[model samples]
Target chain A: MDGGGSAATIDHLFRRQHGRMVAVLTRIFGMHNLKLAEDVVQDAFCRASEIWKVDGLPENPPAWLMAAAKNRALDAIRRERTARNFAPELDRLLRSEWTVAPTVNEHFGANAIRDDLLRMMFSCCAPAISEESQVALILNILCGFGVDEVAGAFVSGHAAVEKRIARAKKILAASGMLFEVNSASEFATRLPAVQRALYLLFNEGYHGACAETAMRTELCREAIRLIREVLAHPNGAAPASFALAALMCLNAARIPSRKDHSGNLQPLSDQDRSQWDRDLIAEGLRLLEHSASGTELSQYHVEAAIAAAHANAPSTEATDWRQVVSLYDMLMQIQPSPVVALNRAIAVGQSEGPERGLMALDAIGGSERLARYPFYAAARADFELRLGHRDAARAHFGDALAAARNPDEKRYLAQRLAACGDVSAPLQR
Target chain B: MAEFAYLYRGGQRPSSPEQSQQIMQKWVAWMKELGEKGHMVDRGQPLEQSGKLVKAGNRSVTDGPFAEAKDVVGGFTLIRAKDIAEAAELAKGCPILERGGDVEVRPIMQMNM
Candidate 1:
């Protein structure tokens, strides 16, 4: 047992290593043997927990686990052969004994395992799966999320989420999809899908679906980490990935200020700028600059720029609503979503006038997708409040509160309702 | 230090045969890269979804490879290492990690023959 190694040091080792081991093994064996491979891997981890409990931790815990898994896999293969019913193809694989020699730099080399993991990420988030499933799968496999955690991300129940994952895996196996990162051209084509996955992940964190504690922070941080990893890789890094990283960082900078001392939600207007993380803000700005190096602006780039403007502001009043509106305009042109248009209308209300913002919001008949979205109601409430329509504002605020999932968000809406002279607050109940 | 097997799991949703071909090609390329780097030792055969597990004194025979939808084991690779750390480091480069699958690392117990 290595004295230097501690459980805290390898906190998520079992979870994170789970994905990496699966990927490397799958690469060696074909996808058909996935079930056996996973069992071997899990057995290895279980053994580690048992051994480490008595013998103390290994110096390189991850490597120790990997080695155990390999031995078990070899044993399983041999056992299968003795049954004489072993597949001829597997028999061939068992016959070839390849050994990995250890070099000082070989372990934890930057390109060694990280590259495989990234490739795996790209493959899992392939455009083949629907965006919803992609996020769900990534959260479960890559992030080690349980079914309940994933279910919380959607409005659906646990069973529905389970079925979705089961259905996804069935499709993947039936389709015989091999796990590999797309080529440069293919990556370019699939960039949107990857970006969407990251975006959805960030949103899950931002919207506070997973949990109330630092889980949101973890999700946001991981989303940025993944996007950064993509951008850092020569072949994997696309401008959009960088933009997404920048956007996430910018949003993340305000995370500390998002919640008050009592853990109540603080709207942008009330959040203390001093609480924002300047270092993260700087990183966000730098990445945003790198993302804008190209002539064409992606929606992610525009969104990041908008977020950057907010981060740079010392107060809500200092936010460059004009620039934000302009970027939103560009974003609408590139990827016109009702959500984007709705957000753009908010910027217009701030930069141009409430009347123009109202007109813009009214032009787009509320899409069904926006029906359950709390932000739509919140934005409507804000617009109506500014236009002196107190009654309308109160009603919209109530709608926003009903749609709100997070306790903090519900509190924020309740406060807003109170301000609108609605003495009766349902939240108090 | 130890031997490790990185396991890949989970199945792809249905797709066109052409897409399946493309995925296979990628898998081959990835394996080739690992082989070239000398990180690959014994590669396990890709097993079909069906298999029987015999366990306990009764040697109970159950439906083979029966697991929850997402918990299936797909494939594995056996790599020798100085220790578990080295094996884990090698497992990091596996492509299956991206597909919501996991890599399990373990040490091989030397059998006295």
Candidate 2:
């Protein structure tokens, strides 16, 4: 491990350390100086890179970075703070330089870091902040995601992410909110937003917003890790959270088989069943069972059940399509949206028939956003192709190809378009 | 043509991962431009704040190379140019300057063997 020290080690340490470091530093410096906390953590990494280039990675690299951050944090406080009782939390050890390291250690210790990360997540997902900003803050501050990544997640530009994060920090600073652990009641209000952000994070990774070269399993992993952290806490665990976790697990299980060799989005039908992670599916099923005890079903519960169905099915054709369609029906009742309708229509085609699916999609029409949704048109083309309506399939495929944003998607649509081409030019034959 | 070193200095390092990545992209693009023009003699790197400084003819080794944070040279790049003016012109597109920083373009004097 020591001899084979690579950038991968630092990359791993960076993801692990950044959020925890920011959290502990935020606990000390307050959210008002969260930027300083982040800068100090970043500086520690820069220093580590320089030193490690010559000295090799230290025996305990994470500990080494933590020590550097601790020193930098103390230096920041001493230089910036007025000669007053700035940190009342450290009144016990503030008098002595010897205690400074101990005090910092106490906050940055594993258990304390875990607690701080939870608190930081809650603070970022504070209901007061707008939902988008909450997500941007979590990705930027906690998850170590770059602006490009977040913006890419958004399917938007970097400028918007910069502004969103800036606005989020402003809200956090001015909201006069304590970064301490939230009360059971307070956490109850915040949990929904936190769960929403986490789910979105997972989905963004699963169905990328850009032409991502890599799968970004890290994002999905981080989302699951945070969800688990929340579920581990007494205040945070609820039926909904467990359901969300179950959904994430079920989806993540299939992530390995989501893409083909050419980097095209592999339909569930075309995916290699052998590549699916059985252990993950088992865990997800276990979590889904636990969620069943709750009186009221959340959207997570509905979604997770659908995912579980797919996970358990031996093949896509053998799946309980009717059950999936029913789940989507429930979902529509709970949260009716054009996207849901589009998904439901495809599922309906599997359960019912292609013509019925086309009818459902036709009903879902009107929104410009849905009109531009590649999946909606692709699904329509798929249903049309199934029903032997070659011209309609070709027309729908044309729309799908035009709407395709990424190369894989474009390639997939091109193939489908070519399939329709033989029938589309029947007059030539 | 003369060789020159562009010493990049004083830009406040980004406080967040997102910001740092954007800054990194700009630098890569800037370096790519220099590389494409065949002006890049050496693709230099950003420096950390910590380094030992040996003074008094290498007799006294001090703790650091920096007197102040802002005065620290963040990175340097070697390039070929006609003269100091052309080197300075090449430095004009430096990414650090977009942030609060300046590029010190100095000609590499040709020493006789």
Model 2: per-residue Cα lDDT over A1-429, one tens digit each: 231324344445665678888888888766666778878888776666544432345778778888898889888776765643434567446446777667776887877888889889988987678877887788877887767767876678889888888888888866543455657777887788889989878877777656664535877888898899999888777999999999999999998887887677788888998999999999999999988875969999999999999998999789999999999999999978888888898888888888898888888855577877788888988888887788888898899999987787898888878878686443210
TM-scores vs. true structure, each candidate: 0.71, 0.79
Model 1 DockQ (Cα-based): 0.02
Model 1 Cα lDDT, one tens digit per residue, A141-173:
666555676676565699999998877655554
Candidate whose TM-score is highest: 2
Instruction: Please identify model 1 stretches exceeding 4 Å from their true place.
Output: A1-5, A81-93, A97-112, A175-182, A208-213, A422-429, B1-113
In order of the candidates, what TM-score does chain B achieve?
A: 0.73, 0.87
lDDT of 2 by residue, B1-113 (tens): 89999887787756545455445445655666777788989766657667988787758988885577778887777899988888888888987788888999988878979
The candidate that achieves the highest DockQ relative to the unseen native structure? 2
Native contacts kept (model 1):
0.00
lDDT of 2 at A411: 88
